[model samples]
Target chain A: EPEVTQTPSHQVTQMGQEVILRCVPISNHLYFYWYRQILGQKVEFLVSFYNNEISEKSEIFDDQFSVERPDGSNFTLKIRSTKLEDSAMYFCASSGGWSYNSPLHFGNGTRLTVT
Target chain B: TQLLEQSPQFLSIQEGENLTVYCNSSSVFSSLQWYRQEPGEGPVLLVTVVTGGEVKKLKRLTFQFGDARKDSSLHITAAQPGDTGLYLCAGASIQGAQKLVFGQGTRLTINP
Candidate 1:
């Protein structure tokens, strides 16, 4: 089955440094999302993208965070300056249709470690 | 903001046992989804329940949506050791923004 794919299974960055997490959503998917989970914590929504722009975002998705669909297949999340709290597993997901019924397909995820 | 509260954060049982996990919320949802995640991997979708009082069964697993659409349950029968994993529940509001509100997961371990 087709699946969303994320690069760099694990990353370690220093505080105040920038990091970019990349994802390639399923080719036919129209909606994309970024979510994070601190160890042992609930998965938290960060941002959602559709039509090459941000559709919605959470408080956790502040100015420090940005998402881009620079190409037809690539969706990327950039953090301007990493903070200790930014250390978590970031997941990339996509859905072909409405979330009400269509299930979102998730990538294995990128684990970010900020020191 | 909407929130889902899952019960019995952790469970461990012997093989062939039956167990249930619950997800409850005060806000009604257009749909609810269940996912299973293993260590070092993202959550994999198990099932999606869209209608109130709906029930779906997949093999040894059964899912139910409450009449009010504010609660859901997952029951696993004859669980095996392979059933061990982290189960998560997510809710989508009726307004349909495409964003999901996730609950703290329930971790289950099926000991052989």
Candidate 2:
């Protein structure tokens, strides 16, 4: 089955360093999103991208966080400065449309560890 | 802000047992979705319920959406070891932005 793919299954970075997580959503999907799950915590929404722009973002997606669709197939989330609290599993998801009925397809996720 | 509260954060049952997990919220939703996640992996979509009081069955698993669209439940009959996973429920507002508000999740362990 066609699925969303994320690169760098696991990453370890120093605090204050910049990190970029990459994702390739389903080819035909139009809406893309980034979500994070802290250890022992609920999955939290970060941002949503569509038409090369961000549609919505949460408080957790502050000044240090940004998303880009640099190419037709690649969507990336960059953190300007990593922190200890930034350690989490980041998941990329996509959907065909914006309707409530559209189901989200998610990638395996990238584990980010900041020390 | 919308929030989904799941009950019985953890459950452990033996093979051939029956169990039910619930998702509740005070805010009405346009749709509700259920997902299952294993250790160190992302969530996999199980089912999506759109209309109120809708019921869908997938083999031994049955899903029901409340008539008010603010709650849902998942019931598993004769659950096996394969049913062990973290189950999460999410809801989307009637405005239809496609943003999901997720519940804390229920960790179930089915021992064979």
Candidate 3:
């Protein structure tokens, strides 16, 4: 089955440095999202993108965070300055339709370690 | 606030036994999804329940949505050692982001 794919299975970045996580959603998917899970914690929503604009975002997504669909296939999340709290598994997901019941296909995820 | 809460955070049982995991919330959802994850891997979708009192079964797995649409459950019958994994429940709200809000997760271990 076709699935979302993300780059860099694991990353370790220095505090205050920038990091970019990349994802290539399923080719036909229209909606995209970014979520994070701190170790042993619940998965938290960060942001959602659709039609080339941010459809929704959580408080956890402050000014330091930004998402871009620079091209047709690539969706990227950038953190301006990494922090210890940023150490978590960042998941990228996509869905072909609008219904909330539509299953969102997720990438294996990029594990970020902010030191 | 956490939109979903899963009970019995951890469970261990002998192979061939049955067990159930629950996900509860005060808020109503447009849908509920169940996922399973192994260590260091992203969650893999198991099933999605959309209607109140809906029931779905996949092989030895049974899933149910609560009457009020605010809760859901997953029951596994004759679980085998391969059933061991982290099970997570996520809620998709109708009015909000439509972003899935996940429960803390229930870790299950099935021993032979």
Query: DockQ of each model against the real complex?
Result: 0.75, 0.77, 0.62
- Summarize candidate 3's per-residue lDDT along B15-88 as a digit string, tens digits: 99999999999999888999998886788899988889999998999999999999999999999999999999
lDDT of 1 by residue, B1-112 (tens): 7999998899999999999999999999988999999888889999989899999999999999999999999999999999999999999886455688999999999999
Query: lDDT of each structure?
Result: 0.93, 0.94, 0.92
Q: Give the Cα error of residue A59 in candidate 2, in Å.
A: 1.2
Residue A69 displacement in candidate 2 (angstroms) = 0.5
Error of 3 at A78 (Å): 0.2
lDDT of 2 by residue, A30-88 (tens): 99999999988999999999999999999999999999999899999999999999999
Candidate 3 deviant stretches above 4 angstroms: B95-97
lDDT of 2 by residue, B64-95 (tens): 99999999999999999999999999898855
Off by over 4 Å in 2: none
Poorest stretch of ten by lDDT in candidate 1 chain A: A96-105
Tell me how far the alpha carbon of residue B94 in candidate 3 is from the true structure, in angstroms, after superposition. Answer: 0.7
Q: What global local distance difference test value does model 2 have?
A: 0.94
Candidate 2 docking class: medium
